[model samples]
Structures are given as C-alpha cells and as structure tokens.
Target chain A: MLQTEQEFIRILRSRLEGTLPEEELNDIVSDYAEHFRIGKADGRSEEELFCSLGSPDDVAREIRATHLVKKAEDVKSCKNIFHAMLATLGLGLFNLVFVLIPFILLVVLLLVVFLFGIVFAIAGPAAFIYSVLQILGIPAFAIWQSPVAGVFFSIGITTFGLLLVIGDYYLARFFYRIGIRYLKWNISVITGTEDEA
Target chain B: MNIQFKKGVLEICVLSVLARKDCYGYELVGEISKRIDISEGTIYPLLHRLKDVGYVTTYLQESAGGPSRKYYRLTEAGRKEEHEQKEEWMRFAASVNALLEGKNDAAD
Candidate 1:
C-alpha cells in the first residue's frame, strides 16, 4: 500500500468539504488494501509494498487538483463579515444614542410642563375657586367649588403622556427591525457565495 | 471516445462493477480492459479515487496457496452512487439517442 491508516487519514482530513466527490475516496482505500495483500503473496515486506505504490503526496496532488479549491474565498468572506459586524455595531449604537438623546430631552421638558399643570390643578385652581365663591356671596355647591376645569386639564395631560408612550414604543420597534435587517443582510452577504451554506 | 474524456467516466464504470460485490484490484483491471483498452496502471488511480471518496472499503483474507488477498467491497454509499451513475448515463445516452434518431433513420 502507498499509505498506512494514519497517512490515509491525514489525506482525508486535508480534503476541503464539498470539493471532492464522495464516491472516489472509497476506492482509494480498497485498492491500496488489496495491493498490500496481493504483494505479500511472495512474502514481500510491508515496507516493500509501500515503496512500489509510490509516494502518497504524488497521488494526493492528482486528487487535490480535481477536488481542492483556493482558500481565498473563505479568507475574504471572514474579513468582510468582521468589518460588517463592526460597522453595523457602530451605526446601531449611534442611532440608539441619537434616539435616546431627544427622548430624554422631551421627557425632561414634559416633566417640567406636568409640574405646572399639577400646580394649577391644586393651588391655582383652589385659589381661583375660593375667590369666585367669595364674590358670589354664598358658596354655590355642597362641594364649594367646581372641579370641571381641573378635570379637563388632567385629561389633556394624560393624552399627551399616551402619545409620548406610543411614539417611544414605535421608535424602539423601528430600530429593532433595522438591526435585525442589518444582521440578516450581513449574514447573507457572508454566506451568499458558499456552495454548502 | 477520447481517452482523456473517458478517464473520469471509466472510473465510474469500474466502481459500479465492484459496488455490486467484492472484487480484487487485478480483477477490476481485467474487467475494465474487456470494456475498453487501458493499461494496468490506470486502474490503480481509479481504485485510489473510489477509496478516497468513501464508496469502498477493504479487508485482507488469505487464500489457500499464497499470501493474504485484499478484497474490496462497495460501501452503501458506493452502491447508491452506482445506481445514480447508471441513471445519469441512461439520461445522457437517451437524450443523444433521441436527437440522432430524430434526424436520421439509419435502420430503415
């Protein structure tokens, strides 16, 4: 035989996946085994059998020429994926920060506006109702003042809060969708040229 | 019909025969020689290819008169490939046949 089990195994491990046809490897092993057995009919040594079979490397070159392709594609794809991931990460973070900065600023501004609405609902309205009661000679209702205006003010504040909540929810969802698409596009880009992907 | 063109397909034929049952390298060479004229050396490369592709495996059994003989058996994969190769050749030959038969009626 031109090869031992270990030598043959080395050649097998070296094969690039999807390059060699599966049927060819089977014959190589059987032929060498037969050759080794038949050559031994005359009481030849194992070493002598190996010598006549020629170098494993010589046989390998012919097989590899048909079965092996260049490594350049894998190397190039790996590099492209790495750079794409880094670029996507950077851009995602930038977009996230961009969304967050304005959101935070809007929240702060809304908070300030709500504090004033609360003051009007509690102190400002209370004083206004009291002064109006004094001018009308007697207190109008059993409750002493109408809370109608404050009721309207609270509804406006709640609606404004709801719009902000909804806008934030949709904005976050949009960013998540974009990130998913970015990941998918990059994955396809990396795997697009592969035979077995 | 070109030797170079037949090279790849010849190995397919050799393996297809062996896949049906165990065969010796010399026996395989003889069988191929009957189908097409080729040197003994050419058969080795084909056997090497079949083993490399995992379509066959070997065992050593001693005969009564001489040394141990290496017997080659077709693995399941080899049998399957033989069937597939047969189908492929059938399709190829049939297509060519249809085309040639359409344009001429040599039998008539």
Candidate 2:
C-alpha cells in the first residue's frame, strides 16, 4: 500500500469519524495534515513521514479512548462508563486483567448487594403481614414467638433492608467517582499511543 | 529502552519541550523523535490529552511561506507540572546512576 499523507489521514478519519465530535475530528485531522505538509516542505518524502508517524489506527484508538474517558468523567452514567471501559480495553491486552477483571468484580458486587436488598425488603413486608394475621388468630402459619415480637422483628428486617439499599446506592456512587479517576489515569499513562513503542 | 519506560517519559518529554518554547506539532515531533525512538503519531494524541486537561493551549501563528500554524504553549499548570516532573526525573536518574556506578566498582 502507498504510504501517503492522504492514506494516513484516511485511515485516521475512518477510525475516528463517529467517535469524535465533528469539529474535534477536523481539528485532529488538520494537525496531522499540517505535520505532513511541514515535513514535505522540509524535503522529507511522504513515505518517510508516514512511517515515522507510525500506525494511524493506533493513534486513532488512543484518541478515541481519551475522548470516551473524558466523556465518562463529564457525564456519569452506566452507558458512558461502559463505553469508556470498552475503549480502554482496546488499548492493549493487559487491560483484560487490570481493567476488565476489576470492572466485572465491581458490577457483580453491586448487583449482589442490590438483589439482597430487594429480597430482604420484600420478605420484611411478607413477614409483617403474617404476624398481623397471627395476631388476628387466623392461624395462617406457625408463629416462632408472640405476634407482637414478630412485628418488631419484621420492622427490624425492613429497616436493615432499607439501610442496605441506601448504602448500596452510596457505594455505587463512590465507586463511580473513583473509577472515573482511575480511567483518566489509565488513559493518560497506561493507554497512550506511546505505550505501543 | 523498554517500551514501558519510554511510555512513562513521553509526557515529561512533551512538557519539557513546550516549557522551553511553544512549538507547532511537526516541530515538536521532530524535536522529540530526534532523541527518542518512538512513533511520531503518538505525540499529537498526547498533546490533545494535555490540552483537554488545560495543561496546554494552542494558538494560530502565520508562517512566512504558508498558512498559519497551530502552536502549542504550556499553561500555568503545565509549567508547574514540568518543574515537578523534571525534579522527580533528575532525582531518580541520579540515584539510578549512583547505584550502577556502585555496582560497577563492586564488580571490579
């Protein structure tokens, strides 16, 4: 294949076209175009300039990762963070262990806590209903203790469940904040195009 | 040099160059590639990242024979970052040099 400025810019544009905003994409493309223009003016051949610039695809991937990570930081959401993580994973295979594993672990942990909270919350209401029925002498189910005692236990379970749910929300928010910082650090340090050197 | 070592130093290299004087993308790439054997394409993305973080800003300057060029200048935060990184790199390099010389003497 011919190593010309057009091909370099084409590859970069094709990869980054949709990922980056239109103006930002144009700005980045202009930088490379200018680089080629100046290099040629300095008496360097197109092929020499292209070869020194390295793979345009790698450069595009790094740019995309940086942009996605920044977007995630600016707007915190599941979709944004997921997109950011996927982009970062494309940087290298090392992220499978470093980024992917930890990400999955955190998601699983959050899910477990959320599910447990819901189960307890529902169970507390059912228990409360059963205790009320027992108090009315309906004899729906055998009581472990007095119906009054049962009411207290049920309330305790409800409160504990509510606390778990609230705590899980705060925990998710905390991780999201820390995760954004980590992603930014990863992009700036671990995932740069220079890493491919 | 190890790839990881080179990757870690690229930021400092870019910052130090801009700390000296603002440079257009091509000129900056030439300056760095003259010393470090790395892809020239990487520097542009690095510059963008620096700009996004407000460490560097760009301005258009007219050239003698061609269209205006976009030159990257370091921000105040960028200057502080450069100074801190330079100091850290110097101390680390000094210690490593000392350790290597000590090992050479012991080997002799």
TM-scores for chain B, listed for all candidates: 0.84, 0.92
**Candidate 1 docking classification:** incorrect
Chain B TM-score of candidate 1 stands at 0.84
TM-score of chain A of each: 0.28, 0.94
lDDT of 2 by residue, A1-197 (tens): 88999999999999998889999999999999999999999999999999999898888988998899889889989999999999988887788887999999999999999888888888888899999999999987865668888898899888888889999999999998898888777766664443455
lDDT of 1 by residue, B25-85 (tens): 7567557767774433345655654675698887877778876666778888988898898
- Compute fnat per model: 0.12, 0.76
Best by TM-score: 2
- CAPRI-style docking class of model 2 based on DockQ: medium
Off by over 4 Å in 2: A191-197, B98-108
Per-residue lDDT value at B21 in model 2: 98
